[model samples]
Target chain A: MGKLFAVVVTIITVVSTAIFIAHTWWLPPDISAHGHAIDRQLSETMISSGVLFVLSQLALALFAWRFGDREDGRRVKPFPGGATPMVVFAAVLVGAEILTLTLVGAKVWAGVFQTPPDPNSLQIDVQAEQFAFYFRYPGPDGRFGATHPELINEASENFFGLDPARDTSARDDIVVPTLTIPLNRPIALTLRAKDVNHAFYVPELRIQQDFVPGLTIPLHFTATQTGRYEIVCTQLCGLGHYNMRAYIEVLPQAQFDQWLKDKAAQQ
Target chain B: MRVRDLMLVGGVGLGGTAMMIGRAATPPGATISGKVTFTGTPPKMKPIDMAKEPFCARLHAAAPVLTENVTTGPGDALRWVLVYVSAGDQGSAPATETVRLDQKGCQYIPHVLVVQPNQPLDIYNDDSTSHNIHPLAKVNAEWNKSQPIGAPPIHAKWESPEFIPVKCNVHPWMHGWHLVLTTSHYAVTGEDGAFRLQGLPPGKYTITAWQEQFGTQSQDVTVTGSETKSVSFVFKATPY
Candidate 1:
């Protein structure tokens, strides 16, 4: 029975560890400028924790197999250091690992979140509703019009509640479900929630931020590759949260400019 | 015992024949036709902005789709009003036919659809993009499901009568209504604001007209035989 228990534990530990090592389910390729650093920090944390996990599991199995089913009623012998030194040593080792990771990880985190956005970066306003994401680009005037909640009428496709008839700045505002930006250019997004809480997550870009109702959050990122990626909501906002997703298209500078021009024409 | 059994059998046979004859003697019923009109100020319909969905926007680029909540017709006529026999309905047949609701150009076709209780409703996504159909049904079971492009149509039905408001969360601008009616004698007004409730049995009935934005109006009317009775409803509309 003891041998079987040890074997079961060993198999479970080995299989789970092997899956991680083989990258059976890994993150998508990094396309954001700051994603490489995040990936490196993630790898370091995983390796450190994984090594500790394997060692501890193996040690437990070995001890159980050797002394678990001793039929002889012999008095159990304690460890040489009376368990205090061992407990202290383990605690210190785990604590140091956590402390080191946190210290190293904070730099990568700060780089993406704490740093100021470039002054020339394009600013886009994002409004998340019950289940859809609407991105608004400041038109030629480069000014966003004020929004009135009372004026918001979904039936007329007035998702942003802008009074284009009276507000000149809102007349040219281009709102779309897809977020299109120039590749390698900094992009700052102001996120607002129309109803409940929501989250904006793009795995390829390594960016995830929350959208709190009644508050506007600012997030900045720079995409290095030109491709179409999915932007999914991670928060459990409502019944349609599972279907809440949009597309993010990164284009070259000239193509992005032309796209903006065409969108503005439609507006 | 033998005599009693023979009498029981005779009674059963007579009862069955009489039921058949009674059903055959019923008339084709009366027809109630009406026009729904409004007085006072009506809110102006604004053009829908489908710019979120490029495919839908391009489809309606020439003439953008307008809001339908308060759709008005010529000469104070109101469209999309539901006229039905609210009272004096002599039982209703079980609905078996499937009703279709389509998502095209990022909008719900018909805007307002009427279905009987337990009737099958098939929702199809006709656009290239995905759509999540959520019916905010309070009395009946509320369900939210996604229909992606090329996916099979969703099969659903309501067990109880309710005025369900349906919306596509992916496209917030996509709004619609599902009115589950218990009476088979009902009609929805067309663009001309005309409605006809056919096959109503001869009796006193409370004819009700329901407008989404203007609330409901009811009037009592008596139908005789298979004659056609004319009824009109005038709703007071507000600009706001």
Candidate 2:
């Protein structure tokens, strides 16, 4: 039974290690500027953890095979240098790894979140409602309109509840269901939730932020590729959460401007 | 045997008379009919592009559906305007018939639907794709659910009086309204922009005509027994 146990343990260890090395399930390609830093940090963590895991699993298998029950009545042997060596080794290895991860991970996080947005970054207002997302652009005035919750009527496409009759600034506020931005240009989004909790998650962008009720969260990213990607809601807001997605179109500067103009005309 | 037969006949007659009397206790109600007209030029509705869902796009390949935000017909008559008794005595019990709202071709069949509080509402997804029905109810509990193709209809009810906005998250342009009221005497204007609120008891009541884009216009209407009250509502439209 002991021999069988050792063999099973060895097989499991080898299989798991092989799977990890093969990278069967890996992240999607990074398409954001700051995503490269995040990717680096993730790879570093995975490598360190993978090495530790393989070494520990192999050590466990060797110990189990050598220390199995022996009917010869052989005296038990303690590990070399006793428990103190093991404790010291674990403390040093884990402490160093944790310190390195913390330092590198904090920098990556700060780069994506804490750093101020570019001075000329395009600003867009995003409102996450029950099951859809509506983006608002300030139009030619470069000023956002005030949102009136009572005036929100979705049938007329007033998803943001901007009262053009009362607020002149709201007259030019352009709202669309899809998000369009220029590639290689920094874009900052002010995320607000009209009803419940929601999240903005873009796998390629390597950025995910929660939309807390009554609170506005800011997120900024620069897309490296010019293509259409989906921005899905990761948080389970309701039954419609699965369908809550919007297309993010990253276009060139000229095309993005033209698209904005067309949308503004529709408004 | 003759006496028993006579007694049975008398009992049946008494029961019939009591039922008639119960119905007669309430006077025959009055009706309010009117047309909803627009004064200015309504905004042009843009055609929806259902290209995201090939199933819906193919369904509407011949003729694309336009936005129903402001569906105006001939003579400037507004369509889909909900006219209901806003304030008056509570009428009879809610209709037992279930109100059905269908999602077909990625659009809400009835752009605007009226239901009484606690009335049964069944939402069905008749398209080949899935739809996420979300009713944003402020006074009542707000909920959302997804209905896949061929899935059983969703049975839901609203407990409070509110103008709930219904939307399909899968199709962002798909929007509808569910107006929940206490009175069942309501009518939605058709292509002729005419509505009739029948069986309204003789009393002073507030008649409200609500258009999705033009907001709401209400007037005080007094109905005397079995009289047809004529009320017309004119909404000022904007291009935007």
Candidate 3:
């Protein structure tokens, strides 16, 4: 019986260590901004988690192997001291991790969301609908028209449901489905939802912002990559929501300038 | 006893089927050709906000107003619309490719194209607001995803077959067609309402022609590399 217990304990230790070492196969999909923070915290946290997991397994194994099944008349003695220090140590470790994570997390989120748009930042107005995104440029005027909320309709196909007939300011508006922005520039996006809540998420750029009507929420991001990436709607709005998409053209600085000039002339 | 047997069989069956599907599916390229025309009445030329819709309003020398409404009365002017064909192969039977559907000026440009099975079909938002690519497909994966400016592009494909209706939820005036075909031979109507599907395998086949408001028609045809087969699909819809 003693031999049997020892063998089981060895197996448990081996399996635990194997899992800790070979975790890449089952690494969770990294889709959040917090994933970036992990680059700094990963090696430290992983080493700690791995060491603790192994040590606990080994301790449990050693205890089981030592005191498991004994035929000899050997009695165990109770500890004069209780396991208080171990508990306190664990609490301190967890508390420290939480505090550090919170501090670092607050900073990362603030960098993307908390700051207001810089005056020179390029701004685009986005309206989310059932399964698509329509982008608006302020034209040369650089101002969004005063739109009525009740005019928002997806069924009558009144997406953005703006009553152009009533809202005279909307007459000069240019509505396009794709968004083209210059590279290496800070862009402030103003999000609005026509019918329901929608989220704008670009994976490569690590940006995700929600669109809510009746409120013009602004989100800012700078694109580090220049390739054409996809702009997908991350909100569940309706039946045809699975294939909603928009093109994001990141032009060179010169081409971008030409585009702005062309746009201005057309306006 | 029945439940236990079903569980054992279902797991193995699904696994085997999935593997076979993966083997059978192969991706072959498809052709996307269609015409842009004023369907009912062509709207007039107006200067549109260039900052908002940059790529869509391509007419530099022409008028700039990106009118969402179709021309109410008829004259031959380039219309705005997007048309593409895609197929849904639930199992892996062929190659995987994708096509783009751009929604600009409240119309679907290029009105028709073809897609392969299990390809990542991208739906684009070019207008300055919102639109939806509502594909009414059953033989394929039927779902809806939205796109806001700077949002991730919606990547979808088919695992089955069906005539899909693509609509913009935000722009009630915006509508288009997504044709998901198993075969590669298909065409879209041009300004003169003509489409030709070339390079068909040497065999007798049933060909179909469809229009959004005009309805659909099918005909029997034979094709070979040496033969130039002529086919016409007409939609007889009286003035509504």
Candidate 4:
């Protein structure tokens, strides 16, 4: 029975580890400029933790197999240095691993979040509602209009509650459901929530940010590739949260300019 | 045994004849027709923006769609108002036929739809983009479901009568109402702001008018014979 248990544990550990090693189910390819560092940090943590997991499981199995049953009725014996030393050593080793990973990961995290966005980066405003996301781009005026919550009326398509009638900047503001950005250019998004808490997650871009109702959060990223990716909401906001998603279109500089001009014309 | 069989057959025939006679004695019912109009200033309708939906944008490029919250017609006529027998109603029967709501051009075909309790409501998505239909129901169970392009129509029904505000989360401007009334006699005013409630028995009925923006108004109407009673409702509207 002990031998069977050891064998079962060994098989389970190997199979699970093999799945991760083979990358059968992994993240999508990174498409942002700062994504490589994040990927590296993630792999480092995964590899270190995986090795520890395998080693601990194997040691457990070995101990169980060797001391399965004392048919001779021998009393239990402590380790050479007592259990305290072993416990301390294991705790230190695990703690060191965690501390090292944190130290290394903090740099990457700071680069993406803590550091301010480039001054030349294109600024966009994002509003997250019950189950939809609306993106606003400052039009030719290059200024965002003030929003009035009282004037917000979804039926009239005044999503941001911009008083276009009075505010000239609001009149030129372009609001749409799709987020389009120029490739290889820094883009900063100020996220706000209309109702409850919501999250913006783009796996390819390696960017995830939360939107609080009373606060505006800023997220910055630069897409290295010119492709369309899905932006999904990770927060459990409401019943329609599962279907809350939008598209991010990264276009070339000239194409993006043309797209903006066309959008502005419609507005 | 033979005599008993003959009596059973005779009894069945007599019962059928009596049932037919009883049904024939009932009146053919009167109709309540009226026009819904507003007196004061109403809010101006704003054009909807469908640029996010390219298909809808191109569809309505020629004539843009307007908001339907307080849709007003010529001569202070109010459209999309639900008029029904609220009180003193004779009776209500279970709805058997299905009601359909369409999502086309990123807009609900009928701004307001009427359905009876337990009536099957079929919602169809005719647009290319997927739409999440969220019905905010207070009395009945609120549900949210998405219908992708080319997907099957969603078949749903409400257990209780409630005024549900239905909206498509994908398109913020897409708003509609689902009025689940217990009374069978109800009509939604058309573009001309005219409504006709037919097959109403001769009795005192409390007719109620419900608008999504404006609250509600009720009036007691009495029908004496099988005749058409002309009634009118004037709602005091505000710009705000």
Model 1: CA > 4 A from native: A1-10, A65-69, A73-77, A80-89, B1-106, B113-166, B169-171, B177-240
DockQ of 2: 0.22
Model 3 CA RMSD to the hidden true structure, in angstroms: 16.9
User: What would the per-residue lDDT of candidate 4 be over residues A79-195, giving only the tens digit for each residue?
Assistant: 669989999987999899999989989987997789899999999999999778889999999999999988887875678988876788887898887899999999999999999
The DockQ leader among the candidates is 1
All models: lDDT? 0.82, 0.80, 0.54, 0.82
Model 1's alpha-carbon lDDT is 0.82
Candidates 2 and 3 compared by TM-score, better number: 2
Residue-level lDDT tens digits of model 2 in A68-132? 75779675876689999989988998899899889989988997799989989999999998777
**Candidate 3's fnat?**
0.15
Q: Report the C-alpha lDDT of model 1 over B1-240, residue by residue, as the tens digit.
A: 011121222223223121121212323778788799988987767667565567888988998877788888887888777888889989866868676677888877657778888888888888898898999899998988988899999999988888898988777878988989888777777666877777777899999999987889999999988998999999988655
> Ten consecutive residues with minimal summed lDDT in candidate 4 chain A?
A67-76
Instruction: After the best TM-score superposition of candidate 1, give how far the Cα of residue A229 lies from its true spot, in angstroms.
Output: 1.1
The 10-residue segment with the lowest total lDDT in model 4 chain B = B1-10
Per-model DockQ: 0.27, 0.22, 0.08, 0.24
TM-scores, in order shown? 0.65, 0.76, 0.47, 0.67
Binned by DockQ into CAPRI classes (incorrect, acceptable, medium, high), candidate 2 is incorrect
Interface RMSD of 2: 3.0
The local lDDT score (0 to 100) that residue A49 gets in candidate 3 is 60
lDDT score for candidate 4 against the true structure: 0.82
* Least accurate 10 contiguous residues by lDDT in model 3 chain B: B1-10
Candidates, ranked, lDDT: 1, 4, 2, 3
What DockQ class does candidate 4 belong to?
acceptable
